[model samples]
Target: MSIRDGGGTGEVAGRPRLAGPPTRLRAPPAASRPGVGRAAMPNAPPREFCTFYVAPPLLSPYFSVGGRACWEIKMRIARRAQRLAGTLAILVSVASATAAAGDADPDVYLLIGQSNMAGRAPIPDDAQGPLDRCVLLNDRDAWEPAANPLNRYSTIRKDLKMQKLGPGWGFAQALLAAAPKARIGLVVNARGGSRIEEWKKGTRFYNEAVRRAQAAMKAGTLRGVLWHQGESNATDPDYLDKLKQLVLDLRADLGKPDLPFVAGQVAKDSPVNAHLARLPQTVPGTACVSAEGLKTIDGTHFDTAGQLELGRRYAESINKLRRAE
Candidate 1:
């Protein structure tokens, strides 16, 4: 018996005949068919048991000489299959990583300013929820499901109990409604009764805001900034001037000169809203949401309903600004 190579194939003593154990291995049951799923054939061997023959005879043929060439060919095929499986595994891993990143990191928005912007309204027991596709940057600077008392994570906020629903809740809900597929991230760092001067460039409030926003940017992106401070600075005749500078400084500091800034009016009918209304005129990318008809909890802070409504208004304005671009 001798063997020879014909092209990349092998030729043995004669045409190769089926040779293996005499044990019968039946075909997979009809249940193994595409839609049926399971291979219920009791006589079927494990999938790894392959003899390349329907019913190989009980012939323990010599595996040397004539069969050596054939054996070598089978080895080459098995090696190639192993390499291909390795490549496929790598591709699956990469795809899973990409999906994980998208799920965890979404579009980020910076929430800055006074108590109202920080959500000073009372949230009822049956208040909404941790919005879908929306996450919040908590006090530890970690992303988590968005919920009421959104400003509770503010490193520079008032007492935790004082933290309640702010515009962030309604704003996220409204934004998601407009862009259902998008995920949102909010970094809230507002201080209660804080004046605009406190958020100016180089100020403690301003510095903390920029830090939190930058950290959030690592997870997602800075889409816009929401401002809702002014009650504490109601009597300042130069409030608008300070505000314009704040916007300018923020745009520069955040490296988003054209960032959309949506400012909400306070609960009180302070002259601050008047200045806020004129913000867009002096600033390039600025919008003011009116607090008219909006009710407050204590003549100073918006009630839960009012807070949610105000958030919707802010989201509407922000969306319009984004669309304009």
Candidate 2:
């Protein structure tokens, strides 16, 4: 009944025992063990998913495996292996928890601008199914599967039927293509005929966009911004200054100094195109995507094909900006 630990040969404390050897203690069952119990982490794969295996000890020529059979020794070795498997299981569970946390917080993107950004083109028949690892911040400030008419959730948006495919759709797809495992969140808040002046900080248009962005940030981090306005301000020479201020203000308000801001040109001929072209030159973390060959449905808004292409371009630009910083 009394016990003291020593070399397997402890009569009392440190010496060899009068008996052949001290009895070995067996481990508890896997179900009762601490870490190897089960897939305890939320959203974690089952225990069977990350199991560790040990080769049978009866297969080796130089080791006990395939050598002589000893029940007590074999049981002790089996218990040690069980503990090892339990530790590995625990490590895998912790890793799963970290991945789930990341899934919970998505990569939020803010899309804002005028009608063009709101997408005036008609939805194509081949529009794909729900994007993998992507979600849209709905008008009610809730997250749902990202789909066509990404601007539908715009708090200051127009009629539903008018909502069509925009760069957000393609942008998300292209972004996912680059990093397949990443989760994307879109927070679009654009109006039909708004100009740069309307989107100025403190205005209702600007306030609503910021509000939605902040709300979405609760479940995700603001990763990038996509802008496609300037059709209304094409002739205004002061558009560049306002855009710079807008970008700066947004970065300040959103608390991401180096936040990537990408502005898409409305049309190749628009005067604002020149200003948009020069954005990246003036701003620190900004880039401009061209709509040069992109055909527009109404000589203003990008058509379905053009919108999708521009979305891919936006993804490429954002990736480069992140790398440059």
lDDT of 1 by residue, 65-119 (tens): 1111011011111224554464355446433433444444577889988888877
Return model 2's CA RMSD, one decimal. Answer: 17.7
The regions of model 1 sitting more than 4 angstroms off are 1-98, 126-128
Worst lDDT run of 10 residues, candidate 1, spans 66-75
lDDT of 2 by residue, 37-79 (tens): 2322244333332222221222111111111211221211123
Residue 5 deviation, candidate 1, in Å?
A: 60
Error of 2 at 285 (Å): 0.6
Please estimate how well model 2 matches the true structure, expressed as its whole-model Cα lDDT. 0.71
